[model samples]
Target chain A: MPFFKITLIRSSIGLPKKTQGVLNALGLRKRMATVFKPVNPSTAGQIMKIKELVAVSEVEAAMTSAEMKALRKPDPGYYIETPGLG
Target chain B: MFGPFRATSPLSGGLLWKIPWRLSSPQKRRQRKRLRLVDNVVATVDAALKRQNMESGRNLVRWKEEMPTEEEMRPKDKYTMFDRKEKKYRKGIHKLPKWTRVSQRINPPGF
Candidate 1:
Protein backbone atom coordinates (compact mmCIF):
# COMPACT_ATOMS: atom_id res chain seq x y z
CA MET A 1 0.00 0.00 0.00
CA PRO A 2 1.23 3.51 -0.76
CA PHE A 3 1.85 5.98 2.12
CA PHE A 4 2.14 9.73 2.17
CA LYS A 5 4.62 11.40 4.49
CA ILE A 6 3.33 14.89 5.16
CA THR A 7 5.23 17.48 7.15
CA LEU A 8 3.77 20.88 8.00
CA ILE A 9 6.66 23.21 7.30
CA ARG A 10 4.72 26.46 7.41
CA SER A 11 2.64 27.56 10.38
CA SER A 12 -1.15 27.64 10.12
CA ILE A 13 -1.23 30.97 11.99
CA GLY A 14 -2.53 33.94 9.99
CA LEU A 15 -3.83 31.55 7.35
CA PRO A 16 -7.50 31.33 6.45
CA LYS A 17 -9.62 29.80 9.21
CA LYS A 18 -10.67 27.01 6.91
CA THR A 19 -7.05 26.25 6.07
CA GLN A 20 -6.14 26.23 9.74
CA GLY A 21 -9.04 23.86 10.35
CA VAL A 22 -7.72 21.54 7.67
CA LEU A 23 -4.31 21.50 9.38
CA ASN A 24 -5.84 20.83 12.78
CA ALA A 25 -7.97 18.07 11.40
CA LEU A 26 -4.87 16.48 9.89
CA GLY A 27 -3.19 16.43 13.33
CA LEU A 28 -0.63 19.01 12.21
CA ARG A 29 -1.08 21.72 14.87
CA LYS A 30 2.51 22.90 14.98
CA ARG A 31 5.18 23.76 12.49
CA MET A 32 7.40 20.77 11.57
CA ALA A 33 4.82 18.26 12.80
CA THR A 34 4.74 15.19 10.58
CA VAL A 35 1.80 12.89 9.87
CA PHE A 36 1.54 9.90 7.65
CA LYS A 37 -1.66 8.97 5.87
CA PRO A 38 -2.44 6.33 3.31
CA VAL A 39 -2.58 7.40 -0.28
CA ASN A 40 -6.32 7.61 -0.86
CA PRO A 41 -8.67 10.03 -2.51
CA SER A 42 -9.72 11.70 0.75
CA THR A 43 -6.16 12.13 1.96
CA ALA A 44 -5.04 13.39 -1.45
CA GLY A 45 -7.77 16.00 -1.38
CA GLN A 46 -6.77 17.05 2.14
CA ILE A 47 -3.14 17.35 1.07
CA MET A 48 -4.22 19.53 -1.83
CA LYS A 49 -5.86 21.93 0.59
CA ILE A 50 -2.62 22.73 2.41
CA LYS A 51 -0.09 21.88 -0.24
CA GLU A 52 1.63 25.21 0.20
CA LEU A 53 2.28 24.66 3.90
CA VAL A 54 3.28 20.99 3.88
CA ALA A 55 5.88 18.84 2.21
CA VAL A 56 4.46 15.51 1.08
CA SER A 57 6.08 12.40 -0.26
CA GLU A 58 4.49 9.13 -1.31
CA VAL A 59 6.27 6.10 0.14
CA GLU A 60 5.93 2.36 -0.44
CA ALA A 61 4.37 1.45 2.89
CA ALA A 62 2.76 3.30 5.75
CA MET A 63 4.16 2.98 9.26
CA THR A 64 1.97 2.27 12.25
CA SER A 65 1.44 4.95 14.91
CA ALA A 66 3.89 3.25 17.25
CA GLU A 67 6.46 2.93 14.49
CA MET A 68 6.08 6.60 13.63
CA LYS A 69 6.54 7.52 17.28
CA ALA A 70 9.67 5.38 17.43
CA LEU A 71 11.03 7.06 14.33
CA ARG A 72 10.74 10.44 16.00
CA LYS A 73 12.51 9.22 19.15
CA PRO A 74 16.26 9.51 19.54
CA ASP A 75 18.24 6.28 19.80
CA PRO A 76 19.78 5.38 23.12
CA GLY A 77 23.36 4.44 22.23
CA TYR A 78 24.24 1.47 24.45
CA TYR A 79 23.00 -2.10 24.68
CA ILE A 80 23.62 -4.98 27.01
CA GLU A 81 25.54 -7.70 25.25
CA THR A 82 24.02 -11.11 25.46
CA PRO A 83 26.54 -13.85 26.31
CA GLY A 84 26.52 -15.08 22.74
CA LEU A 85 26.86 -11.61 21.09
CA GLY A 86 29.88 -10.86 23.24
CA MET B 1 97.47 11.63 47.78
CA PHE B 2 94.16 11.26 49.75
CA GLY B 3 92.53 14.05 47.61
CA PRO B 4 93.25 12.18 44.29
CA PHE B 5 91.77 8.93 45.74
CA ARG B 6 88.57 10.82 46.87
CA ALA B 7 88.12 12.38 43.40
CA THR B 8 88.22 8.97 41.64
CA SER B 9 85.97 7.20 44.23
CA PRO B 10 83.56 4.50 42.80
CA LEU B 11 80.70 5.76 45.07
CA SER B 12 80.30 8.91 42.94
CA GLY B 13 76.50 9.28 42.35
CA GLY B 14 76.46 10.65 38.74
CA LEU B 15 76.94 7.42 36.71
CA LEU B 16 74.51 5.25 38.75
CA TRP B 17 71.81 7.95 38.86
CA LYS B 18 71.79 8.45 35.04
CA ILE B 19 71.89 4.70 34.23
CA PRO B 20 68.48 3.78 35.70
CA TRP B 21 66.70 6.75 34.06
CA ARG B 22 68.25 6.05 30.66
CA LEU B 23 67.42 2.33 30.82
CA SER B 24 63.70 2.92 31.58
CA SER B 25 63.19 5.72 29.01
CA PRO B 26 62.72 3.44 25.96
CA GLN B 27 60.59 0.99 27.96
CA LYS B 28 58.24 3.74 29.08
CA ARG B 29 57.71 4.95 25.51
CA ARG B 30 56.96 1.39 24.36
CA GLN B 31 54.48 0.91 27.21
CA ARG B 32 52.68 4.11 26.26
CA LYS B 33 52.43 2.98 22.63
CA ARG B 34 50.95 -0.36 23.73
CA LEU B 35 48.37 1.38 25.94
CA ARG B 36 47.34 3.67 23.09
CA LEU B 37 46.87 0.67 20.77
CA VAL B 38 44.70 -1.09 23.36
CA ASP B 39 42.54 2.00 23.86
CA ASN B 40 42.01 2.37 20.12
CA VAL B 41 40.96 -1.26 19.84
CA VAL B 42 38.46 -0.82 22.64
CA ALA B 43 37.01 2.33 21.05
CA THR B 44 36.65 0.69 17.66
CA VAL B 45 34.91 -2.32 19.17
CA ASP B 46 32.56 -0.04 21.09
CA ALA B 47 31.61 1.84 17.92
CA ALA B 48 30.94 -1.35 15.98
CA LEU B 49 28.79 -2.77 18.78
CA LYS B 50 26.82 0.47 19.10
CA ARG B 51 26.05 0.44 15.38
CA GLN B 52 24.97 -3.18 15.46
CA ASN B 53 22.73 -2.65 18.47
CA MET B 54 21.01 0.34 16.85
CA GLU B 55 20.43 -1.64 13.67
CA SER B 56 18.81 -4.35 15.79
CA GLY B 57 16.49 -1.76 17.35
CA ARG B 58 18.09 -1.56 20.76
CA ASN B 59 19.54 1.43 22.60
CA LEU B 60 23.07 0.70 23.81
CA VAL B 61 23.92 4.03 25.41
CA ARG B 62 22.01 3.43 28.62
CA TRP B 63 23.70 1.49 31.41
CA LYS B 64 23.69 -2.28 31.16
CA GLU B 65 20.15 -3.36 31.95
CA GLU B 66 18.47 -6.72 32.04
CA MET B 67 17.22 -7.64 28.59
CA PRO B 68 13.51 -8.21 29.00
CA THR B 69 11.60 -10.55 26.75
CA GLU B 70 8.69 -9.01 24.83
CA GLU B 71 6.19 -10.89 27.01
CA GLU B 72 7.90 -10.01 30.29
CA MET B 73 8.39 -6.29 29.76
CA ARG B 74 5.81 -3.79 31.03
CA PRO B 75 5.52 -1.13 28.31
CA LYS B 76 3.50 1.21 30.54
CA ASP B 77 6.30 1.37 33.08
CA LYS B 78 8.46 3.06 30.45
CA TYR B 79 6.71 6.32 31.35
CA THR B 80 7.65 7.58 34.78
CA MET B 81 5.19 7.91 37.67
CA PHE B 82 5.90 11.65 37.73
CA ASP B 83 4.71 12.10 34.16
CA ARG B 84 1.51 10.22 34.82
CA LYS B 85 0.98 12.12 38.06
CA GLU B 86 1.41 15.41 36.28
CA LYS B 87 -1.04 14.41 33.59
CA LYS B 88 -3.64 13.40 36.14
CA TYR B 89 -3.32 16.58 38.20
CA ARG B 90 -2.80 19.20 35.53
CA LYS B 91 -6.04 20.82 34.33
CA GLY B 92 -4.97 21.57 30.82
CA ILE B 93 -2.39 19.75 28.74
CA HIS B 94 -0.55 22.46 26.92
CA LYS B 95 2.30 22.01 24.49
CA LEU B 96 5.64 23.45 25.53
CA PRO B 97 6.27 26.66 23.61
CA LYS B 98 10.00 26.11 23.29
CA TRP B 99 12.81 23.81 24.23
CA THR B 100 14.24 24.08 27.71
CA ARG B 101 17.50 22.80 29.14
CA VAL B 102 17.62 20.98 32.45
CA SER B 103 20.74 19.52 33.98
CA GLN B 104 20.60 16.08 35.53
CA ARG B 105 23.88 14.60 36.68
CA ILE B 106 24.83 12.39 39.54
CA ASN B 107 28.16 13.17 41.22
CA PRO B 108 30.67 10.40 40.79
CA PRO B 109 33.55 9.68 43.18
CA GLY B 110 35.82 12.72 43.72
CA PHE B 111 33.42 14.84 41.66
Candidate 2:
Protein backbone atom coordinates (compact mmCIF):
# COMPACT_ATOMS: atom_id res chain seq x y z
CA MET A 1 0.00 0.00 0.00
CA PRO A 2 1.15 3.60 -0.70
CA PHE A 3 1.93 5.88 2.27
CA PHE A 4 1.98 9.67 1.93
CA LYS A 5 4.77 11.44 3.84
CA ILE A 6 3.45 14.91 4.73
CA THR A 7 6.09 17.34 6.03
CA LEU A 8 5.08 20.81 7.24
CA ILE A 9 7.71 23.07 5.65
CA ARG A 10 5.99 26.36 6.55
CA SER A 11 4.11 27.42 9.69
CA SER A 12 0.30 27.51 9.73
CA ILE A 13 0.08 29.95 12.63
CA GLY A 14 -1.99 32.69 10.87
CA LEU A 15 -3.88 30.26 8.64
CA PRO A 16 -7.56 29.37 9.01
CA LYS A 17 -8.73 27.42 12.06
CA LYS A 18 -9.79 24.45 9.93
CA THR A 19 -6.32 24.35 8.30
CA GLN A 20 -4.65 24.33 11.74
CA GLY A 21 -7.06 21.58 12.83
CA VAL A 22 -6.10 19.52 9.80
CA LEU A 23 -2.41 19.96 10.63
CA ASN A 24 -3.04 19.05 14.30
CA ALA A 25 -5.04 15.97 13.29
CA LEU A 26 -2.05 14.84 11.16
CA GLY A 27 0.21 15.12 14.28
CA LEU A 28 2.25 18.08 12.82
CA ARG A 29 2.46 20.69 15.60
CA LYS A 30 5.57 22.56 14.40
CA ARG A 31 7.36 23.30 11.15
CA MET A 32 9.43 20.44 9.58
CA ALA A 33 7.35 17.85 11.45
CA THR A 34 6.61 14.81 9.24
CA VAL A 35 3.66 12.41 9.50
CA PHE A 36 2.94 9.34 7.41
CA LYS A 37 -0.62 8.38 6.62
CA PRO A 38 -2.06 5.85 4.22
CA VAL A 39 -3.36 7.23 0.91
CA ASN A 40 -7.06 7.73 1.53
CA PRO A 41 -9.78 10.33 1.11
CA SER A 42 -9.41 11.57 4.72
CA THR A 43 -5.61 12.05 4.36
CA ALA A 44 -6.07 13.66 0.94
CA GLY A 45 -8.48 16.18 2.42
CA GLN A 46 -6.01 17.02 5.20
CA ILE A 47 -3.20 17.48 2.67
CA MET A 48 -5.42 19.66 0.50
CA LYS A 49 -6.28 21.88 3.47
CA ILE A 50 -2.61 22.68 4.24
CA LYS A 51 -1.26 22.23 0.69
CA GLU A 52 0.64 25.54 0.68
CA LEU A 53 2.48 24.84 3.96
CA VAL A 54 3.45 21.21 3.39
CA ALA A 55 5.47 19.07 0.98
CA VAL A 56 4.04 15.64 0.27
CA SER A 57 5.64 12.57 -1.22
CA GLU A 58 4.32 9.04 -1.59
CA VAL A 59 6.47 6.15 -0.35
CA GLU A 60 6.10 2.39 -0.44
CA ALA A 61 6.73 1.61 3.26
CA ALA A 62 6.02 3.69 6.36
CA MET A 63 8.73 4.19 8.97
CA THR A 64 8.03 3.55 12.65
CA SER A 65 8.29 6.32 15.32
CA ALA A 66 11.71 5.11 16.46
CA GLU A 67 13.07 4.80 12.90
CA MET A 68 11.87 8.31 11.98
CA LYS A 69 13.43 9.81 15.13
CA ALA A 70 16.71 8.01 14.44
CA LEU A 71 16.82 9.42 10.88
CA ARG A 72 16.53 13.03 12.19
CA LYS A 73 19.05 12.54 15.02
CA PRO A 74 22.71 13.33 14.33
CA ASP A 75 25.47 10.91 15.39
CA PRO A 76 27.55 11.89 18.44
CA GLY A 77 31.06 10.96 17.22
CA TYR A 78 33.97 9.91 19.48
CA TYR A 79 34.18 6.96 21.90
CA ILE A 80 36.69 6.71 24.72
CA GLU A 81 39.39 4.15 23.87
CA THR A 82 41.92 3.11 26.53
CA PRO A 83 45.58 2.73 25.47
CA GLY A 84 46.03 -0.82 26.82
CA LEU A 85 42.96 -1.82 28.86
CA GLY A 86 40.39 0.13 30.86
CA MET B 1 71.65 33.54 47.34
CA PHE B 2 70.56 30.60 45.20
CA GLY B 3 68.66 30.89 41.88
CA PRO B 4 64.91 31.79 42.13
CA PHE B 5 63.88 28.50 40.38
CA ARG B 6 64.47 25.20 42.16
CA ALA B 7 63.89 21.62 40.87
CA THR B 8 61.58 19.86 43.35
CA SER B 9 62.08 16.08 43.55
CA PRO B 10 59.71 13.63 45.28
CA LEU B 11 62.65 11.69 46.76
CA SER B 12 64.51 14.73 48.25
CA GLY B 13 66.45 13.40 51.24
CA GLY B 14 65.65 15.40 54.46
CA LEU B 15 63.22 18.10 53.24
CA LEU B 16 60.81 15.58 51.59
CA TRP B 17 60.85 13.32 54.68
CA LYS B 18 59.80 16.18 57.01
CA ILE B 19 56.64 16.97 54.98
CA PRO B 20 53.59 14.63 54.77
CA TRP B 21 53.89 13.98 51.05
CA ARG B 22 52.10 10.88 49.72
CA LEU B 23 53.11 9.00 46.55
CA SER B 24 50.71 9.01 43.55
CA SER B 25 47.38 7.13 43.96
CA PRO B 26 47.33 3.38 43.15
CA GLN B 27 45.69 3.87 39.72
CA LYS B 28 48.07 6.74 38.80
CA ARG B 29 51.11 4.67 39.87
CA ARG B 30 49.99 1.78 37.62
CA GLN B 31 49.47 4.23 34.69
CA ARG B 32 52.98 5.71 35.22
CA LYS B 33 54.48 2.19 35.20
CA ARG B 34 52.76 1.38 31.87
CA LEU B 35 53.80 4.78 30.36
CA ARG B 36 57.45 4.19 31.41
CA LEU B 37 57.44 0.71 29.77
CA VAL B 38 56.02 2.18 26.52
CA ASP B 39 58.56 5.06 26.53
CA ASN B 40 61.45 2.61 27.03
CA VAL B 41 60.23 0.42 24.11
CA VAL B 42 59.83 3.51 21.87
CA ALA B 43 63.34 4.81 22.76
CA THR B 44 64.89 1.42 21.93
CA VAL B 45 63.11 1.20 18.54
CA ASP B 46 63.98 4.85 17.74
CA ALA B 47 67.68 4.26 18.53
CA ALA B 48 67.78 1.19 16.23
CA LEU B 49 66.01 3.06 13.40
CA LYS B 50 68.29 6.13 13.84
CA ARG B 51 71.39 3.88 13.50
CA GLN B 52 69.99 2.25 10.35
CA ASN B 53 69.00 5.60 8.78
CA MET B 54 72.45 7.15 9.59
CA GLU B 55 74.15 4.28 7.67
CA SER B 56 71.99 5.06 4.58
CA GLY B 57 72.31 8.89 5.06
CA ARG B 58 68.45 9.16 4.85
CA ASN B 59 66.44 11.00 7.55
CA LEU B 60 63.02 10.00 9.02
CA VAL B 61 61.54 13.35 7.82
CA ARG B 62 61.84 12.20 4.16
CA TRP B 63 59.63 9.12 4.83
CA LYS B 64 56.95 11.28 6.56
CA GLU B 65 56.37 13.32 3.33
CA GLU B 66 55.86 10.22 1.10
CA MET B 67 52.19 11.19 0.55
CA PRO B 68 51.38 13.93 -2.00
CA THR B 69 50.28 17.45 -0.93
CA GLU B 70 46.53 18.34 -0.63
CA GLU B 71 46.60 20.55 -3.77
CA GLU B 72 48.19 17.75 -5.81
CA MET B 73 45.99 14.91 -4.44
CA ARG B 74 42.70 16.76 -5.11
CA PRO B 75 41.71 17.00 -8.81
CA LYS B 76 41.61 20.57 -10.19
CA ASP B 77 38.50 19.84 -12.30
CA LYS B 78 36.46 18.47 -9.40
CA TYR B 79 32.95 20.00 -9.40
CA THR B 80 30.15 19.71 -6.84
CA MET B 81 26.51 20.36 -7.64
CA PHE B 82 26.09 22.58 -4.53
CA ASP B 83 29.10 24.78 -5.42
CA ARG B 84 27.97 25.14 -9.03
CA LYS B 85 24.43 25.96 -7.99
CA GLU B 86 25.63 28.53 -5.41
CA LYS B 87 27.92 30.21 -7.96
CA LYS B 88 25.14 30.37 -10.54
CA TYR B 89 22.75 31.84 -7.98
CA ARG B 90 25.34 34.39 -6.85
CA LYS B 91 26.12 35.42 -10.47
CA GLY B 92 22.49 35.62 -11.45
CA ILE B 93 21.51 37.61 -8.34
CA HIS B 94 24.79 39.64 -8.08
CA LYS B 95 25.41 41.63 -4.80
CA LEU B 96 21.90 43.11 -4.69
CA PRO B 97 19.86 42.24 -1.59
CA LYS B 98 16.93 39.85 -1.68
CA TRP B 99 13.38 41.18 -2.52
CA THR B 100 15.06 43.63 -4.94
CA ARG B 101 15.08 44.03 -8.74
CA VAL B 102 18.01 41.57 -9.24
CA SER B 103 16.35 38.92 -7.05
CA GLN B 104 13.12 39.40 -9.02
CA ARG B 105 15.07 38.72 -12.24
CA ILE B 106 16.51 35.43 -10.91
CA ASN B 107 13.41 34.24 -9.10
CA PRO B 108 10.38 35.29 -11.12
CA PRO B 109 6.87 35.67 -9.71
CA GLY B 110 5.40 32.56 -7.92
CA PHE B 111 8.87 30.83 -7.98
- What does the lDDT read for residue B55 in candidate 1? 23
**Candidate 2 local lDDT, A1-86, one digit each (tens):** 66777777778766668878888899999988888886654555555455546767667788887999898888878788779874
Q: After TM-score superposition, what is the CA distance of residue A68 in candidate 1 from its true location, in Å? A: 3.2
Residue lDDT tens for model 2, B12-69: 4445543222223563344334333333322332343344343211222332234222
Residue B106 CA displacement from its true place in model 2, Å: 24
What lDDT score is found at residue B100 in candidate 2? 16
* Overall local distance difference test of candidate 1: 0.48
Candidate 1 error regions (>4 Å): A72-75, A82-86, B1-111
Model 2 complex DockQ against the native = 0.01
* Steric clash pairs (candidate 1): A77-B60, A77-B61, A78-B59, A78-B60, A78-B61, A79-B60
C-alpha RMSD values across all candidates: 29.8, 29.8
